[model samples]
Target: MQNDNMKCGLIEKTESQFVDSIEKEAYVWCEKNWKHDDYEHQHNRAQLTFVEEGYQYFHIDRKIYLVPQHHVIWIPSEKAHKITSEAQTVNLMVFLFKSVFEDEFYQNVQVFAVPPVLKEMLLYASKWNQSLDENEEQDLFFKAILKSLPNFCKESSSLEIPVPTDTRLIPVCNDINVNFKYNLDIDSLAEKAQMSVRSLQRIFKNETGITLQKYLQLTRILKSIELIDTRQYTLSEVAYKVGYQSLSAFTSSYFAIMQVKPKINKN
Candidate 1:
């Protein structure tokens, strides 16, 4: 078997070749089983990625956003970001466009639900790649998609957790993420971070703009969403897996963050 360094080198080389092949004014790339290391990079062109089958975690702008299945995420030009897909097989569709539009919609990172019409459009566009001729027809087709984005991508979801840059809080956040299934109280977190409870609370809020309790709650909800998407567990099982003893409480928190009910895939 190849060693870890060899595997990483091969993946990086493959990614570099892939990026070099798509230097176009507009491009569409689709893939299945798309797995890559957490490579942080930025593009000169704005990007929109649709997760069709599996989920992806987008680390951008000091926040980690969960782009679950059937959701789309927009990343503006020159924004530093990295993506991690834990799933073994992920179906993804990506669109890259020149940052020519002055619309406010393309100015910020957003993860939103994909409506049926938009979904169809994305699927149809998947046939075209960077090699497509740059003519008026092609321009119009891409422009139509751009214009329609602001309309269809209105309901943004807050499936994100702000990351703190402070050194003292990094381990705290990591612990919460890794041990999300446990009831991690402030006192324990403070102890782990080797700080007073009040200092931890104040500094965490100052750095991440969210209280420790709220941050923990958001972390649990994010994990629950991932578990629910897997279809391997019931809703109650998902709730408990994310540290909630009460299913109703889990449902409430999930809805509040996602703005939609937990979709239990009964397949």
Candidate 2:
């Protein structure tokens, strides 16, 4: 049912319902309404979420990835996940099924960091969604994108925390964002939420699939990397800004999580 405002984000239309046949093992459609939703769920088919605009938080496992404009997050089949829309932004997703992905389904479900080539291909495919079976050229185009899906896989280890859809969690999440520098602890956070520490941990695990401490460490690490890459902060300053008291500890954590030494990616 369309809401009074008439906004929707999760589109669930089938081939017969939306478009004509595209090719064997593949179909195409659009999600006209991407709205604010709460909760985490996974599907039986590996799917592609192509965000044409706006921002959101994509939760898989227990790590949180901040999805900004033109970013797409792919959720593997049966991997529990939740998504929260960035305030007042359009959330777009292009879902691909397992058969279309072919043999690459053996790899882990990925939230690909979409590059230009992938973006262009998706845009082109979206345009032809209504033009399925137009010609042999259309068949080739579909095949090309199907092959490239594996190439879009990105290496992301940390997952986002899944907060329950509740008024209490919202303030708590906002507080975490605001006071990121302070020593983050479960007890303090629970105090803010007016809930017991155990309760907070329980829901956080249910939503994000990881411990709160682990999620916080990942969040700090991501923040540190962004600052370092900007060429504005020295590694030392970046360390302190992200709540790491010692550079060595920070470096160790960074290397352990990302499996790469900290250095500017100039290219």
Candidate 3:
């Protein structure tokens, strides 16, 4: 509801919802930290949301995705989802009209690497609001941006952290998401959910496509990535911050999952 134009663009309302004032093809909302009102909502247009400074978490269809900086989240039209962040974040969000791109490419929710060229174009395009009337020069730029999408948007699966859909397991899932640092044992989690350990194991794997142990480890690693990027804590400190008991154990786990060692650079 609070919209600051910032010489980037203006916010416009359509059907009681606040959306970026779009041009013929797309509209961009660049913000330091955008506070959204609705918990879950759908749009008639697809979106490409890129983080400019930090990371964001998105929940869609009972699954969660960890979207980091310089990555693009491609959300198709009519997909109901919600976004959140552990701290204040900055993002460059672009909404594209459904007609602007091919259906096959934009039909599903995906996270991709944002190529440099596309990043520049989006930042430049964010400066102007769309109009029904476009000059030849503006039209050329719009077309160029559209053509560049395929090159910049390469689907990535590594960052997706699955969340369970079952109502019974929802509480456990939420716990791991928010409290990844807690000592979460499978037996204790199952007991807390009022289900037997074996039953919980089966249900968790069936619904989330991951074993409980893997999910917890994945969640911790995702949190570690955020913490390491902050550069405020040493690698050892970050490991403990995210619930690992030993630095060696945390390093091994981090390398196994991330294919890289946890390194912090203050510079």
Q: Candidate 1, clashing residue pairs?
A: none
- Which window of ten consecutive residues has the lowest lDDT sum in model 2? 14-23
Candidate 2 per-residue C-alpha lDDT over 140-238 given as tens digits, one digit per residue, 9 for 90 to 100: 776687677667756553533455565676666776666666667778789887999989888766655667677667767766655664566777788
Best by TM-score: 1
Tens-digit lDDT track of model 1 for 1-267: 234332211222443222333335676767778776667866566788999887899998889988888889999877878888666468888887775578888898988989999998888787674334556666677778877888888655467788888888998998888988887678988998899999999999899888877888888987776677678888999999999888898999888877778877554
Clashes of 1: 0
| Candidate 3 positional error at 110, Å | 1.0
Q: Which candidate has the highest lDDT of all? A: 1
Per-residue lDDT value at 228 in model 3: 73
Give model 2's TM-score versus the native structure. 0.52
Off by over 4 Å in 1: 1-24, 129-131, 155-157
lDDT at residue 148 of model 2 (Cα atoms): 76
Off by over 4 Å in 3: 1-23, 124-138, 148-151, 182-184, 229-231, 245-267
